[model samples]
Target chain A: MTAPVDVSLIVIVVVITALVFDFTNGFHDTANAMATSIATGALRPKVAVLIAGVLNVVGAFLSVEVARTISSGLVDEARISPVVIFAGLIGAIIWNLLTWLLGLPSSSSHALFGGLIGATVVAAGLGAVHFGAVLSKVILPAIVSPVLAGIIALTATYLAYRTTARADSGTVTKGFKAGQIGSASMVALAHGTSDAQKTMGIITLTLITAGVLSPDSGPPFWVILSAGLAIGLGTYLGGWRIIRTLGKRVSEIETPQGFAAEASTTAVILTSSHLGLALSTTQVATGAIFGAGSGRRLAAVRWSVARQMVVAWILTLPAAAAVGAVAAWVASAGTVGIVLVAVVAIALAAGIYAVSRRRPVTADNVNDVGDDAAVAHEPAVPAR
Target chain B: MTIDWASLGLVSVVSLAAGVAVVVLVSFALVGLSARVRPRPGGAEDGAPTLSAGAGTAIAAVCLAAVVAIVGFGLYVIVS
Candidate 1:
């Protein structure tokens, strides 16, 4: 038999590349957790992002059990190639940018999972997929986690207002804003623990497959540092498009609602992370926001906006997978194929950026979108 | 079926727990500090930073550093 591949170089490259994706994940999804607070004027924009960046780093250290899930549970690590992972990252990055440009709060978790699943299926056939892990660990959690968070937030919001019914509006707002600081931080910590590890796991899996590292090995120091730094920097840049959508469109978040929503989200996210569940923080946060709104009143939640976000959520996995599968198919043609995919992805990104310049959405213009604004400024119904 | 728990870095685990404790404690402290500093009608403190944004950022940073260090060490052990 041929000697094992000298995977050291590939490991180094894939680890760094994975970190690049982690960093993008951080910036891309920051809006999912903090947009509502920023939109409500609960936190200054810069201050909000800086805090998220730091917490994301801290959270990354909390657990690696989820990383294990990603490394071993998602696919048969024995059968894949580093090139497949690279192509999948490209697919994910492209989808993330496309959705981000339109200011949609799509699920980054789903995108990553989709990318892995797609690449594995294309590279090694469907037998490589761990359906049990996909279902019990990823898919089921994705569906149930958000709904559970929403229910908890709804109950908490209902109680929060009831207990303070005699208090004046000013008193309630002030109290909850004070409480919000603690709850929000918990969510951030939980987010880092849950999300950053995906990259770590992927990199580790790449190392194992390429024979650069043992099968039982965890992510290396460089992998962890690079992933954390990348995500931290991304978090600092902030994804303002999504921030407006989540912060303003879902609900008019008063202080009490914000407090309850944040508290419930923290509880749900932390519990999931500890259990090694790879649930989407975006879904949990959004569900909590919706529950908080409904707790106040039926009309408090903008159903139209919620519908649009749901549609994006439903499309995230399938769309990213389709892109990844196509990229994998093309890349299978070897070096020329890889070059073509890269070129097309780069061109698509540039084109999206050019179109976005027409109505630029920066931190400055993030909050400018009004309540009636449709998803991507076009009318769309909920996909699910 | 035995697990080598030592290789997992128990210190890192404790560090993570400590970080969470610190966030919770600091949040309570901040709220109290804001209460002492800001004088509003009905004693409501509006200036306190929302826990989700500020605390979230701090926690994320800490976790990132920890993960980097732990994974870095893991790499060293495996590579050597």
Candidate 2:
């Protein structure tokens, strides 16, 4: 049999793929952080993205802990090769693109985990997964983080409006829109700090697996800059499909509600990041958005859209994991495996782009939610 | 096929990731709290003045610098 493929080339390819995944994550999730503010006229779209892009770059510079978690805590890196991780990232990239095209706010965190898990299990059996870490760090947080943040936001929004009940609606809207800029910016910063690092950790781990870096080494400067730039550029591109869904479909977010949601999101996300807990920014932001809507008197929170998002979140990990595992198995076969994986990735990317063209959601059409009053009265779908 | 460099690398990467996360979280807490507690000129009517384009850019700069240092140091530790 031919000798095992060149390890260095594999490492480099994986690293690049990881960055590509990171870039998609940036655009896919940027809507989670800024949709409400943009919807409420708090920040202009271009300005909002510029602000978010800058914060994401800064945030990437902020933390390595989450990166470490992805690199080491979730899976036994020793059992699997860097090539395995590369295959997993390919799975993640595919899932991310699929969700982005649908404008579904799924969990990128889960996607990554699923990808890693799939590859690892295929490479080294179920023993590769750190179940304890998965339970304590991933599952527990996934279940509670969003709900907890939601309740807090709901209460905060109610009190915010009640306290200022005497103020004119116009006055409150204008004012909160202003406050939203700051809070939204903070969330973006936190997003960058936490999410970018995940990719960095992955790249660093690849380096370690390839014996290019020590096991305990953090991600290098070039990795950090490249990841930061990739994510920042993605954020600038903006995921308008999700923006439409979140900003207009979930609820008709007023300025005050947007402010409250952003503020609550900033607080909860920042706290979780500090605790070194890997939380889904999508979940946290979604919870806060719904909570803000429900808190307002007469403001309708569409459980239908919320239900859809939740469903997507629950399925993200397993679905992506399955994809990753398949990719890993194929990639491990030999030269053909590598070629097959690359062809699949390219084909999948092109497919998603083609599908997205049918009902293109750009900044121009992003705000077209059709009669806010009518949508508010739409029937709710049961939460699954 | 080799020593458990993967395990060591994993641990080191985790610490580096966590350390940076903590710094960002703490910084955000401080900034968020300060914005809340500090007295403001126009109250909530005019929104927040400090969260401008310039402010966002500045925060990003700090974040980038911190990430570079943390990762760089972690790599050094692993290599040595």
Candidate 3:
């Protein structure tokens, strides 16, 4: 480890970058919990995000098991430096912005893991990454959780429709809308429990590498509080672009379908969080939404849109890893190199934001599918 | 490094079961509510329902209570 005095400055810089990444994570994933709720008119856009933001804060205080996993289990803290963690954060934030610009609901968790693993490999060699842990905890869970969520949602949605087939349509819609609000709130809370801890773990790992904290220590109370607030703030801002895609472009979500999708997402995310598995909330939500679509009728699903999201999922890890590796190489040269990387990252982020402003999607225009000609032109899925 | 296949299996089974159960219960509750005969807004005479309205209301209440209990249990698992 480096001398404590020499590394303290680097540690502070790294922590801020991690918080920035956490902020992007918050907005990038806001759609996962609230998209269907917003789309179905169960809650207004502003009210939905406010509720999600508060619940996320409450959920962040729920458990520390996942934090322990990221701090010590993923990569060797001794081999990597705070600078490396900073580079990894840069990679994740950039990937998140790129995907968000394209309105794709990619996995923020996977991007973080990929960036960290990639930067570690470049800085400390391949052995620094525990491939075994990655296989069991990260890779395997990513594959299974989404498929499982999809199947459960499919069955539940089908059963839901069948059970209520003879019911008065007006009463059924009202009841399911009420149920959807409860389920969506649970999903938001579950998201806070899982996603916020990834940042906490990265910050804790940075502190450990700086010689400020011992190895394998859990996040301090302050770390948890700041991480929670950062994410909550991001959630409140909302990711209207991705929300539009998930809510309107995925399929026409009825009240029952929305309820089923949110419930399945809640169950899978909470279960994984309890087990300390860092599964992707985005994937689970996407899968459940598709499942809900398919359950109603295979014809009801827009397979082309689903195909595009899956392609994004397949690319997120490798793409983020590549950027992270390049960033680590550049940042490792010296203090000057680190400053250059930070400058370039900020410039690139500003450029992306400028581009996004050209055809902006905000809460007022989020559900305006008819006015947005591009979204309207997509071939419609025939509802059964 | 070693994959805990057992834990993986447990998570998968539990999540799937819980997801399906919650949906089913909520749907059944809605169905039960629909079965009950609500007095019309214009004060029309209530039509006789196939199932007794009292029984349907009872069934709906029980199912909704079960869903609430499960959600509470989920919250407890997170905190403790």
**For all the models shown, what interface RMSD does each have?**
10.1, 12.0, 2.6
Fraction of native contacts, model 1: 0.00
DockQ of the two-chain complex in candidate 3:
0.59
Tens digits of per-residue lDDT for model 1, A1-55: 2224665544554566577678779978787567766766677888888888898
lDDT (Cα, tens digit) per residue for candidate 2, span B1-80 = 13233433343344324332423432332343333333344766345445444554465456546644543543343222
| lDDT by residue (tens digit), candidate 2, A1-384 | 222355467777888899999999899888977899788878888888888998899788777767776677888878889768988898899999999998888888889888988988998899988887787678877887677667666766776666545333444455466667767887798788878888898888888888877888888888898999999989989999888888888887877678777767766666566556778888888888888788775337887787788889988989889989999999998768977998989998999999999879887778786644435567333321
Q: Candidate 2 regions off by >4 Å?
A: A1-7, A371-384, B1-80
Misplaced by over 4 Å in model 3 are A1-7, A371-378, A381-384, B37-49
Question: What fraction of the genuine interface contacts, i.e. the true contacts, does candidate 2 reproduce?
Answer: 0.00
TM-scores for chain B, listed for all candidates: 0.36, 0.45, 0.79
Q: Write the per-residue lDDT of candidate 3 for residues A156-212, one digit (tens) a residue.
A: 999999988866667789999999999999998998899999999999999888878
Cα lDDT for residue A235, candidate 3: 88
What lDDT is obtained when candidate 1 is compared to the true structure? Answer: 0.69
Model-by-model DockQ, in order: 0.04, 0.04, 0.59
lDDT of each: 0.69, 0.75, 0.87
- Compared with the true structure, what per-residue lDDT tens digits does model 1 show for residues B1-80? 22223422342243234323332333333333332333454544344343444554464456445534543443332122
Place model 2 in a CAPRI quality band: incorrect
- Report how far off residue A225 is in candidate 3 (Å): 0.6
